[model samples]
Target: MVVRRCLVLLVATAAHVGCTYDFDAFMPSGAIDSDLVDDTSSGDAVADDAAAPLDSAIEDVIADANVEASDDVSVETSADTSADTAADTSADASADGSADTGGATDTGLVDTATPDVPVSCPDPEGKALGTHCYFPLAADNWDKAKAGCEARGAHLVTITSAAEEIHVESIRTGKDRWLGLRRPAGSPIGEGSFAWITTESVTFKKWGGGQPSGAGECAVLRAGNDWADLGCKSPRDPICERD
Candidate 1:
């Protein structure tokens, strides 16, 4: 029994040297042994110290994320406000332009007058010349040509200006054409004394050389684009004029 007790004490001493309490647990319940308690406070302190840096890093990440989110929201709000302002400005400008156009229309500044539509020549064969229509007729005497022109609701062509004479010259055939000029009773044998069949005033004349010569009553448009008196019975093509 003595040897066994000595061996058990040797084992407990060895176990205490190894920093274990397995052998100390067999002591009396009321006995206080300082080395019997496992001192884990130092390990827990090390763990807490290690976790602080990670926690701080996590807090910094969260703060940065919150700041970035705030910036994004602010940018989006500013962009939306700018877009709304531009839209309003565009709408206002369009409204002003429309109002201006309406005001112009109301003030009669817009030319709403129907544009003058030109009247077409009455006869399909009639050629439009200047402001009138001209029809070159077949060979006929002055009286017959006058009658033909009246039948067609027209008058024998009259030259009222040099421009009109140029216009008539453009359509001159190879032969002379009868004009509407004739001498009236009590009239002299001069260019001024002759009158158009339409009774228009004798405002212009192109008598050839020194002629009226009282050669005949009626006049003819020579191929050289001048006028000469001729007999009323002579056969010549006539040019008819109308609006």
Candidate 2:
């Protein structure tokens, strides 16, 4: 009985050994599970990191777009301001130019139309004759007397007719004054009608009473105030009339 019991015990022990689980294989399985879990975690972390970088890039693009818009607005505003300034400057210059031109024209017009006034003659050396104001030249040859009067811007007194000559003779002042009358030597007596050399006509005349009849063809005024037909070369004071 004891031997049989020993044999059974041995067989049972061997079978147990043969049916026992393989520890090495179990360990390898557990290790495989751990590696899978680690790999999955690492992949998840990498995905998260890539997503963050993409978001950052999107944000940078947005910021750049905003900066460009601001710069464009500033440029447009500056251009507008400059244009307004230029327009104002042009208007002001035009106004100033017009005003200056008008002023210049007015000045030019005013300068061209003013008239000159006449001057008055000085007095005392010569006496005034008639209401018309005549001056007498001092005694000189007839031609010289005439030239003297002309130099003073006057002409020898002109006598129109015999009646005017008579009238001039009435104002005698007791001196042999020159008359416009002149008789060339050897000229006929009555044939020479009295006339003024300046006017070349018998417009005014004055003769002393019965004066220019015959031998008195050559004549002189009795006073500085009278008129008579006289010799051409006779030296005497002459009267000058201002026009």
Question: By lDDT, who's the top model here?
Answer: 1
lDDT of 2 by residue, 1-243 (tens): 443333333334434344443434544544434444455445435445544655577689989999999999999999999999999999988788778796343444445665744434353344343433356668577878878877887777665556545444543346676766666556666534554566476554455576676654445676644445665566677766565
TM-score per candidate, chains pooled: 0.53, 0.39
Question: Residue 58 in model 1: shift from native, Å?
Answer: 77
Residue range 93-174, candidate 1, lDDT tens digits:
8788789887343454667788756657767456776568877777578888888887888888888889888777766666
Scored against the true structure, residue 184 in model 1 reaches a CA lDDT of 76
Model 2 alpha-carbon miss at residue 37, Å: 99
Which residue pairs overlap in candidate 1's backbone?
none
Clashes of 1: 0
Cα-lDDT of candidate 2: 0.59
lDDT to native, each model: 0.74, 0.59
Model 2 misplaced stretches (Cα beyond 4 Å) = 1-119, 123-133, 160-173, 214-219, 224-226
